[model samples]
Target chain A: MSKIKVVHYINQFFAGIGGEEKADTPAELHKGEVIGPGMAFQKGFGEEAEIIATIVCGDSYFNENIDKAKAEILEWVKDLAPDLFVAGPAFNAGRYGVACGTIATAVQEELGIKSMTGMYVENPGADMYKNKVYILETRDSAAGMRQAVKSMTAFALKYGKGEKIGASVEDGYMNQGIRVNFFEKERGSARAVKMLIAKLNDKPFTTEYPMPVFDKVDPMPAVKDMAHAKIAIVTSGGIVAKGNPDHIESSSASKFGEYDIEGLCDLDESTHETAHGGFDPVYANYDSDRVIPVDVLCDLEKEGVIGKLHTKFYSTVGNGTAVASSKKYGAEIAKLLKADGVDAVILTST
Target chain B: MVKEIERAGFPVAHICTVTPISMTVGANRIIPAIAIPHPLGNPALDKDEEKALRRKIVMNALNALQTDIDGQKVFEG
Candidate 1:
């Protein structure tokens, strides 16, 4: 059989293009050759699979204009005649991983092609798209480059040969944490019996597979009277003073600031600016009212729909903040709101 | 975000464009919004339509606050 053709997708950096400045560069298809990391994969897979084309675009370009990027990239790959597609070994770069995962999953879904990418476990992109494609668990840095490439190539070769691929771990990919029915070496009854026997014998027994534990939260005491409840408006949109006096970091914010707007009816660009770096800053800057909508909430409060508006609005940047940090911030904000006798909160996110 | 807020001891409701994700993530109550960026109002539309959509969703959210449910409840009218 002839060598299976493959196409590789990579961000601008990996394609020898510059950083954010080149982020808007449109998708380009290079035929008959492998780019940087593709060469490594090609070497590993040998002639069993050949990278016939390389599609490169900037991370910001794809993120900002996802539909256009997807259209252009898919159109480019349509003519490449690739049997398999591969995206980045995106290390711990969140944007790169997201770009890779998005494109890989899209190609797999839309074009019916086998697609694979690699990302670290902590990369949010993995959690978002892992269920849709083969995502190899990779090191935080490129230290695992050789091994990652080799493993990805092995899976690609198997896909090209139409062989039965095993579980994610067995196939050298991260588990998406979804389960499917598959024939097992041991029966369910036998496994259960063994576990029971071990437990009765007072021996340590591990579950065959442990389910993820979702922290159960005790429900809050309901407000006695909705009409008498003091409602507060809190936002993770990072609406801070123009200079960001509290110095909240854009993405991974460690601190939250409460701004007093006691006499103010509305927040304007001169008074507030977005510390959120995730979305376009233009809209939030020109119209701080859009992100927070405190004016609307205040109007409702004046209508006696709520008892009182909190004197201070809590603000923080939500983008790329870990769940743990977010939880901590939530608890802190809750404590403050509770102390002030605020019965309810209307929190918004951009 | 709504889950974290509710978990912190407040009856919380989420006004989100993606109801499926919020519902799956165990949001106590959900009110569907227009889109991700402009959840309440759509600048592209005329002021009347924008107000109507916002009013409808906001009302639904307020209604969600008053009602009790056994599990994650999505407001649909």
Candidate 2:
């Protein structure tokens, strides 16, 4: 009956504002004016959905101050009364995809609105937030701008129309491996068995979905002095304080803070919490040390079998993190450890 | 990438859950872990058992650093 009101979210560059220098700009809401891809979306959606407002902020700004950024953005969007939200066709840009994914997931969760974004598979944002939000698979370059926008808008239209939407990959969003409850025409186990039999018979049968390949990384050469080396432990298992008072993000983490336990031996529920979004949070919450095993490492350090342990251990939520970003963070930490003259590292992953 | 790091002359060993994947991907030295999430010790086990498991794996990793091999090597207990 009425036009579907939409709010468009974009980063600094697409906002036609500035570059890295403007990356820290706080969130601002503008009404009646369409900027950047907002113009393209306005054109694509035609009159079906009106781009009621456009929210823009610098990527670095949001990253550096996520809580403040999310708060400000949420404040701006509260009154816009948009039925749907759309972020960028971020292409292969890492930060933009992250920003888009973060904002979209938050909007979907907090506002109870459908949100969508377009990003290439390599963008790392797709892997991290694809399960939480609708991320349309896009090409690495801006060449697919028109198509991506059109596709995203079409999906938005379906949402606006209250029509049942199909599965993610099929509907242009990256598959989150989420199982949806629906009445299927075919029986599930029977179908799978039939397919399995066909595959066993050497018949060409496609799996319902194939798992994405995480880039295989080779192992570095062994440490020269293992018996006498100071090995540090690291974990993405979100082992922090009981309430995560440090406020580490659940996913796509940009901050890693270390807790000091120099004199203390073990971690208790009141002392530590998990911020990792990848796994079931219940298990980790019960025993923070179980995830990172700081207690075990501490005992190992106390035994004098190895050199003095590094006082501070690195921590960040690794769930839904991009491989490239993870590698970069690893390098940064490695450099820090190297500068500290640390001999060897025993990085524990969960 | 790890090889590149190794080529840069830092000797590193991997304690990985996916030994097959690590071997296939060509790790210089691989020490096996129980699972993907908790690689060293399973939380399901008691504290002492978990410690023993972790100690064993860490020892294997330590051994990997000392032992010289021609290609990707997996430590066996």
Name the best candidate (by DockQ).
Answer: 1
Candidate 1 lDDT, A1-350, residue by residue in tens: 99988899988878888654465577888888689898898898786878889889877667656789998888777767578889998876666777899899988899888888997876767777888898988876677788778778888889878998887757878877777787879899998999999999999997768887675553454456767777776777788978899999988788888898776666677898889875556656765666666666666677887667778888898765766787788888888888888777666665
- Tell me each candidate's TM-score: 0.71, 0.52
How good is the docking of model 2, as DockQ? 0.12
Root-mean-square deviation (CA) per prediction: 5.6, 15.5
Against the reference, the lDDT scores of all candidates come to: 0.75, 0.71
lDDT of 2 at A111: 82
lDDT of 1 by residue, B5-67 (tens): 677678776665546445545666777765444555566767557556665666576667777
Candidate 2's iRMSD:
7.5
For residue B75, model 1's alpha carbon misses the true position, in angstroms, by: 4.2
User: Once superposed on the true structure, which residue ranges of model 2 sit more than 4 Å away at CA?
Assistant: A181-205, A209-350, B1-77
